[model samples]
Target: MSALDFIPELGHRVRESVPRLGAATRFLVLGLGRPFHRHFSIQQWLRQVYGFGVLSLALMVVAAFFTGMVLGFQGYYALVRFGATSALGTLVALSLLRELGPVLTALLFAGRAGSALTAEIATMKATEQLSAMEMMAVDPLAWVVAPRLWAAVFTVPILCVIFDLVGIFGGYLIAVPVLGVDSGTFWSQMQSNVSFRGDILNGLFKALCFGLVVAWIAAWQGYSAQPTAEGVGNATTRSVVAASLAVLGLDFILTALLFS
Candidate 1:
């Protein structure tokens, strides 16, 4: 194609995408707002929590455990070079709490819960379930989207905490018995060096932000998906890819904002 032809095509694509983006944003805003003004079903929220949070726990734990062990193995060797092997605990704890815990947990959540959410909603759309609800005068955003979004927002931080704890133990297991580091020194160094506000709270904040991004992307993609089988599959794939990128990109921005 000629340059002039490409320019208009690009502009047309941008114009088409802009409205879709706006519609999704409006859906999210409305979804968040409706629960406050109407009857918010606790059961529905709980179900979503179980789906988004509880179902993904095992994967998160395994990821966290191996991550910690790898950190312990790497950090021990690195610190040993400088005669600072005693700092292994602080290193592992700080790495997990500050970065790996939230980042990896969100990535796992995106792949598991987030993709499932996109697929479920897209399938509902494909099957005309959402249309039937609309015919029955039910708002799909309030009935379907809000609970999942809020559930993710609440659950992700808790998962991140679990990940951090499991990771610490994993580090201890390797650092103490396997590597011959003193248990007392590991715990003591971590306790002394890692601050509650600086490490733990900041990491939780990152988790919350990541959760919002992942859930929002998943819900929006599903809600806006084309009502076809292929479209549903595409939406699910996009949700995972988009959520992962957003988690990593936002992590950098959050780190700059929180640490700077």
Candidate 2:
């Protein structure tokens, strides 16, 4: 076939796929709608919340601590040259609150929790457990998706806080030990320079949105996976890619909206 012939054929398939995308989007919205309702079961909610929060806490802490230290070391000398060493706190606060805290935590959560959720659901689908649930008249949306979605929404911001704490401590260690910054002065600068409302709230907001995106993407992908091992593998991979990209895209949009 000529190249032009192939192009027309491709356009036809692209148009055909649009409806499937729309269907998926609709299903996603439905899933999100019921996640916050009164019937969303306290027991199930507690389980997923604990899983999302407590399970991920240690990892977030370590990651943030190291991230903070690196930011401090990297920014310190640059600020010193401009006689703006006092700007370190503002720099750390802004960078962590705006970028590193939410982004890194989301990426980690996508890799860890997102993958786990995808795999778990994919495995269940493969084993026909999902089918069994349907046969029993149990709404998988209510029993499976709602709790996890809400849990992720609530847990992500908490994880972001953990990330911020670790990152700041890392900065403190590097600044105090290596740069010889007076501990009291460094903390005082941070307190005076960093506005809690702007920095903390913005970061937490980003984290919450990221959590929702990651969980929904992973769940939607996994739940809709074809009934084959290879399909499950593909779903898992796609879940991570989609969640990460969405997190980045949403962050940019949120930044513009919040800051503008």
* TM-scores for the candidates: 0.95, 0.91
lDDT of 1 by residue, 7-115 (tens): 8999999999999889888887887776774546768889999988888889888999999999999999999999999999999999999999999999999999999
Measured by TM-score, the strongest candidate is 1
Off by over 4 Å in 2: 1-10, 13-17, 35-39
Per-residue C-alpha lDDT of model 2 across residues 1-260, encoded as one tens digit per residue: 58589888999999988987887787678767775665567699899888878998888888888899888988898898897777776677678988889999999999999988888888889989988988987777777887888889988998998888888888888888888777777788888867777778888898999999999889888888987999899999999999999999999998898766
Clash count per candidate: 0, 2
> What residue pairs are clashing in model 2?
64-167, 65-166
Query: What local distance difference test score does each model get?
Result: 0.93, 0.86
Relative to the true structure, candidate 2 reaches a TM of 0.91
The weakest ten consecutive residues by lDDT in model 2 span 31-40
Residue 27 error, candidate 1, Å? 1.7
Which lDDT value does model 2 have at 202? 80
